[model samples]
Target: MTTTSLPIVSTCGTTGCSYNHDSDCHAGAITVTQGCGTYVDVAGEAGIDTRAQVGACHRSECVHNTALECGADSVAIGPSGGVADCLTFATA
Candidate 1:
């Protein structure tokens, strides 16, 4: 599979963010928590493998979170998950 680098947004300093430290998203999987009442995937671009490339959520309203930590009950990959700005993210 061709590996393509997707443009990642910085993780916002909102509570419950995954990319809080060094923006090191190595999970290769992403899912939006339920409490935020929304779902967003940071890995779904062409040539980008969401299951093989780790990513971080920049959305502050994500339900799967609690102070920059992934609090989601489950995580999955799909095409609906788009990119967003992480208000708390910074370049490593």
Candidate 2:
């Protein structure tokens, strides 16, 4: 039987997230780094365009895991190993 692929969605629910653009996380495929923190926090105002300082991908089991691109619909970002960021995340 042929199976259809379901749409994947992610969202950055952090208090002050900089990876969100119009409620969308445009940050490329993120990977985990050797350091403790895997993300760079941006300071300014909410709903404003901010930059996501590349860090690392805590989710090692992500389906879009690759050396070049993140095939997953979105990525969860937050503390190391925590669900948070995404590329195709939509706001509810």
Candidate 3:
């Protein structure tokens, strides 16, 4: 099923992600692949109020993914394989 609203990014532990501040994701939206496709390793911060939402998800095998979008109530991102990943991803 399709989700009416974007999924909230509850937390992020990607240390070098530009969208991450104080362990929270501030990107307007994030793309989930094997890793976080939208992760930027720059030296800046997204607006403090700009909480991230899942814009797209490529893990079709993930239970939280529906129609290329995230259907989870919330998702967490973290460091994995030297990149950001969707820690909430689970097999169907």
Among the numbered candidates, top lDDT falls to 3
Task: List the candidates' TM-scores in order.
Answer: 0.28, 0.35, 0.87
> Scored by CA lDDT, what does every candidate get?
0.32, 0.38, 0.84
Error of 1 at 6 (Å): 23
Candidate 3: where are CA atoms >4 Å away? 1-4
Tens digit per residue, CA lDDT, model 3, 1-92: 43347888999999988888899888878899998888888777754576788889999999988788888998999986758888999995
- For model 1, the local distance difference test gives 0.32
The best-first sequence of candidates by TM-score reads: 3, 2, 1
Off by over 4 Å in 1: 1-56, 81-92
Give the RMSD in angstroms, all C-alphas superposed, for model 2: 9.1
lDDT of 3: 0.84
Q: Provide the clashing-pair count of each candidate structure.
A: 17, 11, 0
lDDT of 2 by residue, 1-92 (tens): 11122122244444344545554444442343322132345774333233332333343454544442334433444433343434332222
Q: Candidate 2: lDDT over CA atoms? A: 0.38
The superposed Cα distance between candidate 1 and the true structure at residue 76, in angstroms, equals 1.0
| Residue 29, model 2: Cα distance from true site in angstroms | 7.4
Error of 2 at 73 (Å): 2.1
Q: Rank the candidates by lDDT, best first.
A: 3, 2, 1
What TM-score quantifies how close candidate 3 is to the native fold? 0.87
